[model samples]
Target: MQRRLITSVLLGHYLSAFTALGIPLYLPRILSDLAPGTPGWAIGVLFVLPTLCTALAAPIWGRWADRNGCRLSLLRAHAGLFVGFLLAGFSPNLTVFVLALIIQGTFGGAMAASNAYLSTQFKGGDLSRALNWTQYSARLAMISGPILLGLLTAQGLGLDLYRYLAWLPLLAFVLILPLPKDAPKHGLASKKAEALGELPQDMPRLLAVQFLFSFAMVVTFPYFMPFGEQLGIGNDALIGVLYSLPHLVYLLALPWVQKHQGNLLLHGLALLAISNALQFWSVHAEPLFILRLLSGAGMLLSFVGLHRCLSQRSQKGSAGRLFGWFDSSGKWAGTAAGVAAALISQSFGIASPFLVACLAAMAAMVLARPLLMTSREIPA
Candidate 1:
């Protein structure tokens, strides 16, 4: 039964991620079709607007999950995502598309809710394993989504792709229906307070570290296709593969890292910084591919380390709220990073965001040292 439940959760993430991330692969074309001659900044706005909405809504959903139940919260989120995707698919103009995205963001807390639900079912090494699997599934979706989009778009179905993809979240919703439902429990506030006491003295610092890492990541994400084009890789399929290769590496490496979990925060940070810096010099495909693999490994290490820390600090009853805050922080950071990337790219150059990401990663590494040292003293 436990194994079945875990499988369902993984499937849920995979489907949800495919819908959430995959549909966006066609956004540039969609926007072009809907709003011809749109400025580059508009693309960033379209990407970030929903993220900001999601950031705002995550905490409320988290609190609801703590009070109501993770399963119910997840169901609600998935339903909303389904509707939002439908709206986006049928949108007649950019205004409708933007509204649809906001709706999607407002209801898209499935990942956070899923994490919270699993946090209740496992702890210690088992918890780490489960979280790593969840991340792996998400990375798998990231790898496959673009490839799927590229194939669909190549066949001249680009305009109709969103409508087809809209069914995915509904499928995810159906998959989640068979999972065991958690009942609402009392004393959640007290449990949260207790968890707070168990948290490290510099918990805020860890949150800052998470924010910086996410910001660094998002700063370069939406511009990858353009960046590849700048490098003379014009084929959509090739660009999709370039975008997916790092996540593939990350997915493959997750199990090994989960097995050998340790204080790898600093090392991960160093690698991530180096990888981002290498992007500046990657005018060719081979070097970029190698650097992307390194970046993926680095991201897996840092993100897993942070998530483990957060999970360790959460009490069962309040896990949703805790993970909710973590999700919110990352979302907020992503929102800002999206806007910053657009403005930077517009003013400076297309390549400037990569440099900015490298600098941010270095800063995160500097701030992470104290946390890393302190984490070593804590018992796993």
Candidate 2:
């Protein structure tokens, strides 16, 4: 049953990726073709609006899922993605495109829904293993989704390809239809302060750590292209290879890392701090490629550690609400990181965010210590 659930969600997640990250990957081109002469601020709005809406709406969906069922919530989320992508694909003007994004954000949250849905069925190491599988699907999609779109773009299909891709999430919606229902369990982890009544004491701190990790890592994304250009590496293929290498590491290393989990958060954060900081001095692609690989290893460790922490702490009835807020936390962090990256790059240069991220990683190490120690006490 567990294997079936994992396989089902993983496949659905892979299909959902076309509309999820795929559209965002090509948004600039889409806007240029469909809504030419868009202002700088509007471009930012186009980038940030759907994310902001997702962050705001995730908790609401989570709460609703807790009352109804996670399966229903998961279905609703995919449906929203379908509608949002369809609207954007067929949008007649900028207003309609913006509305489409709003609809997408307001309705779409398959990741959080999937997590909550899985949490209903597993706990401890089993839950972590399940979540890790989701990561594999996500990483694979991230690497391939953009590449697929780029290939189509090269073939002269143009923006119409994105429009055609709107129907992709419907595949996910259909895949979810066969999953078993998760009935609501009221106040299952509410604050009665017992082992079952309340969440782990470190959950708030865990969320903060999540925010820092996201902000630090994402701060580098906006300017990575410019940073590569600064190092005289203008080949798009090489840059794409560098960008995708870290995810590839996760694909190869995550299973081993999860099997031998011990102080992963600490080691991962330390490695992440060093790797991010060292990027500041990268004068060529060779060293940058090595650092990116190390960063990928660190990322896998940190993500597995943190997710393990979440699964260990998640009680049966409250998983929906908890994963909901967790996803919101990460979304807000990404939004903030984008703004901060823009400002820091404008003020200091492209390399400054790496240093900022390094500091953030170090700080996360400090905050995560208690949580990690507490996590160690949970039975494997």
Model 1: pairs clashing at backbone N, Cα or C within 3 Å = none
Candidate 2: clashing pairs of residues = none
lDDT of 2 by residue, 197-255 (tens): 24457778998999998887788888888898888897988887887888899999987
lDDT of 2 at 280: 80
lDDT of 1 by residue, 139-205 (tens): 8877778777777888777545667877888998998898887855545456555454343467688
Clashes of 2: 0
Point to the candidate with the largest lDDT. Answer: 2
Candidates' C-alpha lDDT = 0.78, 0.83
Clash number for each model: 0, 0
With candidate 2 superimposed using the best TM-score fit, by how many Å does residue 94's alpha carbon deviate from the native?
1.1
Where model 2 places Cα greater than 4 Å from the true spot, the runs are 186-198, 376-380
